[model samples]
Target: MEAVAKALHPDSKEKRYCNNEIISISKQLLVQVLELPFDSKSRKMTDLLKTFDGLDITKYANLVSQKLKINQDIYYYDNEHKNYYRGLQVMYQQENENDKQESIKTIRDADFEVIPQIDILVVESIWEDNKISHAFAIANKQTLTGLKFCPHCNSKAFDPKDKNYSRDYEIHIIQCENNEGKIVKKVKLDYIQKPFVPHIMQNKTYQYLLSNGRQHEFKPTQYFITYDLETVPKIVNKKFGKSSYQMYELFPLSVASTIRNKQGIKKIFFSQQDGEDFIVQWLNQLFKEAEQVNADNQYITEACTIDDTIPYSMEVPIVGFNSSRFDISLIISQMQ
Candidate 1:
């Protein structure tokens, strides 16, 4: 499963280890090679690959056949997927196009042609202390045809491909393909400007880049003890302050951490001088509790676990943002 989904978990240090496409190609080939001795009536998704003897993996284990050159099997399938092919991801595009065509239909009777087309115009309401100062209005609109110009050939006749929509900026872009159906250029189209205003919901900013608007909400769980820290500069009376430092105070002099769990969120604050005392007491106790839970697998729930042994998701997870650098450093400095 890790070999099949390596694209989702990339390893920067070892680049070739998680080559998802190549690994998938190799595994698919191995499935075909190991199935030669099996009967069609018994073999299914794949033939069981197990061996009692221990030996190093040969090139034959991953490669299809010794007759073909190494470079020839680099990519198992053709770049263009026009029809059903084994181990080809692009083959499902035909099914998606069919589904799109089936969804669109026109009115059958001629009598319904009297229904006129009207455009709905949206305008932003001025928000002052969470109050709506403006209301929605409807108006007529002039429709404009959008045409993508190819950057490579400077041609107006082109199709959009590899389209991506950004919710933050509320824009859609695509690689422009010329009449020959060769993608060679990039073009952008903005859909939120003019005759349009973003709707404000619950006083939250309109996220134009997200396909589903807003980010995932934060919810606390028992397995992880999530926390965030706020820091401020240390200060003293000017009458006695000048002797300590000449230029500026660079270190975080005062730190406050708000931790969340099944109980609730609570904040603990202290001066830098008291940091050692805080770590030895509160943080140590929290770590001990987490260790006990992991030793007994108390964090695992029956629904998310496979039997009493394997868990779909179970960890003493340390969750934070920039905690690896700033927050962690400050805590470890006092601990050491």
Candidate 2:
């Protein structure tokens, strides 16, 4: 995950977050801190530390306060020293825990940057031309090849099925040079919706240049994407007889490889890791990759199609074992 982060933003210097350690600490803290319930006699600042070992709850005051966004000034008062801690520092005390509502209130108050859920497939289609039709492989085929100049008059005919052309389909009867001019081939086309840009044949027949002793080539365009998954541990009786960590797995690999081999995928990238923070970092990288793929496609091709052109240029597939059960489930559940 850090490797891709570094690759995307060459200047990024911060060490990657340790997902496993954070999750473990967060879980332990939730139980210890929240269990006191503000009214418990055991609710003490020192007691809270005894439970949440790794977290500096005081620094999180800002995180919590910003989340709450209330007007109250939260500061730490050193009762024994007769002074208040500078800079919004609040020490956890037995009395402080008395207001479990404040902790809950703090969580509710802090200003957090919430990442909006993005529909990657929809997003990719929106940015590129005729992107939606291209993404629906079953509906449209040969996207790049579909737009070709009329062999006879050099006229550009829009694809018959493309919604851009509202006019009725027509059969264009043209003379076939292959058969003497007498033989005609019935060509059906959508003539109403013509692309703003001129369409050229991508898979042109190649010939050997006798003068240079070199072969001409028509390279197909391609794209790539990388993914990662983080899973929470769970014990289930479905697969294992005894209790064990049921790792969540996602099938992005199967989907990606299928799209690649079956759908003319040129390249694929798979970056696998464990834990939630890495997953967040991975998603950020994934979005950047998708954006880059769209940019590169538009740069070279006039009208790129998900069906005709490669889906990912630097296709990175992040596969995690048992991800389908855990990580995918979490994402789906969270979305809902």
Best by TM-score: 1
TM-score per candidate: 0.23, 0.19
Q: Deviation in angstroms for 237 in model 1?
A: 19
Model 1 gets an lDDT of: 0.37
Clashing residue pairs for model 1: 166-209, 167-208, 167-209, 167-210, 168-208, 168-209
Off by over 4 Å in 2: 1-221, 228-233, 236-277, 299-327, 333-336
List all candidate RMSDs to the true structure.
32.1, 33.7
lDDT of each: 0.37, 0.35
lDDT of 1 by residue, 11-62 (tens): 4565645355654554554445454454423444334434412111222323
Which ten contiguous residues of candidate 1 have the minimum total lDDT? 66-75
Candidate 1 Cα outliers beyond 4 Å, as residue runs: 1-222, 233-276, 292-308, 311-314, 321-325
lDDT of 2 by residue, 1-336 (tens): 111112222222575445454444434444443444543233464475577433233334334233322211222335577533222322223234545666566668875322111000001233445432111111111232354223422223456557754342223323333433233457777768654532232212222122234233333444444333433344333455677445543432221211222234444333333333333444554556556555544323444534233222333343444556555664444331
